[model samples]
Target: MKIVSLRVNGAGQAFIARPGTTLLLALREQLGLTGAKRGCAQGACGSCTVLLDGQPVVSCLVPAVTVDGAEIATIEGLADGQVLSDVQQAFLDGFATQCGFCTPGMIMSAEALLDRNPDPTRDEVNEAISGNVCRCTGYEPIVSAVLDAAARRRSRAGEGAKL
Candidate 1:
């Protein structure tokens, strides 16, 4: 096993990674961060999505060793104590989650989207989360949630609120 270090959720983390260990596996098994699920292991499903260096990536397809010293952000890091991020709050308020299997990935994708584009059109939001798939609560709710989240973020920015 090789030791891999990464900055996750703004904290430094280190864990042993066996050969061929994917970032998803290391996050779930090694670091005990199970927010990113292993839905398809094949990277077809965005269930294992996370931010690597501020860009969204399918964690299941990235080898742990290849990303040593990278900055990673998972769903677990989206909340500030009990306060949820704009995307997360929008998802909850908009009733965008059902079964919740795809919530984390969807939220991560939305987070990346808003980070780059504070105000996004519906088409842009759809394109941002195109990689993620939600079996329940069709795309409408998810899309609406993303749009709502964008508004929330903009409002917060106007108020000088911190995310």
Candidate 2:
């Protein structure tokens, strides 16, 4: 077993996992953060997406030991005191999810995109979330939600700058 220390959802956490354990397994099994689902463990599916140091990464492809001392963010961390982030709210408002199984990964990907590019074009949005596959809501609503979230974030930032 390998001891790993990571900051998850803004909380410091330490756990022991098998040497070859993936970050996804470590989070779900060791830390009890099951937000990142295990889909195609081969990294073909983005169901295991998470934010590593504010960047989107397929947790299934990351080794737990490699993530030592890294800050990770999952779907559970996207809300603030029960208030959803703009991206999450946009997903709900846009009805971007059907089964909701892929919602967390999609949201994580979109959040990463918006973080890097506050104002992204449709093509950019597509490129950012291309890794995530949603068989339920189609891709239109998901793209729409990301675009809406970006706009909302820009609007909020603008308002903050005015203050």
Candidate 3:
């Protein structure tokens, strides 16, 4: 077993994992963070998406050891003290989720897109979440949620609100 240290959801975390262990497995089985789903374990599905250093990544495709020293953000870390992030709230308000299995990954992907481009166009939003396959929401609500979240973020920033 190898000991890896990384920042998870704004907190420092360490875990002992085998060399071939995927990040998804490490997060779920080792760290007890089940937010990253175990969808297509081959990375074809975006259900296991997470943010690695603020970039959306397929956790199932990434080896746990490869994330050493990187900052990993899971859906569990998006909220603070019972307050949901703007993107999460938008998803809820827009009814973007259906079965909820894809919500975590979709949210993380949307968060990464917004982090880089707070005001993304519809095409960009679609491109950002393209990897995530939501069989339930049919992609319309998800797109709307991202756009709504971006607008909300801009409004909050205009008011000098801190994220």
Candidate 4:
């Protein structure tokens, strides 16, 4: 067993990761953060998506020990108390979520995309979430949600800039 340490949702966390333990398993089983779903462990599905140092990656395929000291962000980190992040709020308002199975990963992907590109085109939004597979909501609303989130973020920045 290897002791892997990382920052999860802005909190410092450490756990003993047994051999071959994926980041997803560590997050779910060890840390008790089950927001990132366990879908295809093969990394083909984005159900276990998380942000590693601000980059979105499939947690199921990421070895826990390999990412020691990394900064990890999951869906749980997107909210401040009762206030939702712009991406999450956009998803809720845009009706982009269905079945809720893929919502966490989808939201994480959107967060990563918006973090990097405050203003993204529809094609960029599509490309950002291309890895995530959502069976319930066709990609239209999801794409719209991402774009809307970007706009909201930019608007917030604009307000901050004026201050």
Best by lDDT: 4
- What is every candidate's alpha-carbon RMSD to the true fold? 1.9, 0.8, 1.7, 0.6
In angstroms, give how far residue 4 of model 3 lies from its true place: 0.5
Instruction: Give the winner by TM-score: 1 or 4.
Output: 4
Query: What TM-score do all the candidates reach, one by one?
Result: 0.96, 0.98, 0.96, 0.98
* Tens digits of per-residue lDDT for model 1, 1-163: 7888889999999988899999999999988999999999998889999999999999999999988899999999989999999899999999999999999999999999999999999999989988898888888999999999999888978888653
Point out the worst 10-residue segment of candidate 1 by lDDT: 154-163
Per-residue error (Å), model 3, residue 99: 0.1
The global C-alpha lDDT for each of the candidates, from Candidate 1 onward, is 0.93, 0.93, 0.93, 0.94
Using lDDT as the measure, what is the rank order of every candidate, best first?
4, 3, 1, 2
lDDT tens per residue, model 2, 1-163: 8788889999999988787899999989888889899889989889999999999999999988898899999999989988999999999999898998888999999999999999999999999999998887779999999999999999999999999
Worst 10 residues of 2 by lDDT: 129-138
| Candidate 3 RMSD to the correct structure | 1.7
lDDT of 4 at 115: 88
Q: Distance (Å) between predicted and true CA of 101, model 4?
A: 0.6
Best by TM-score: 4
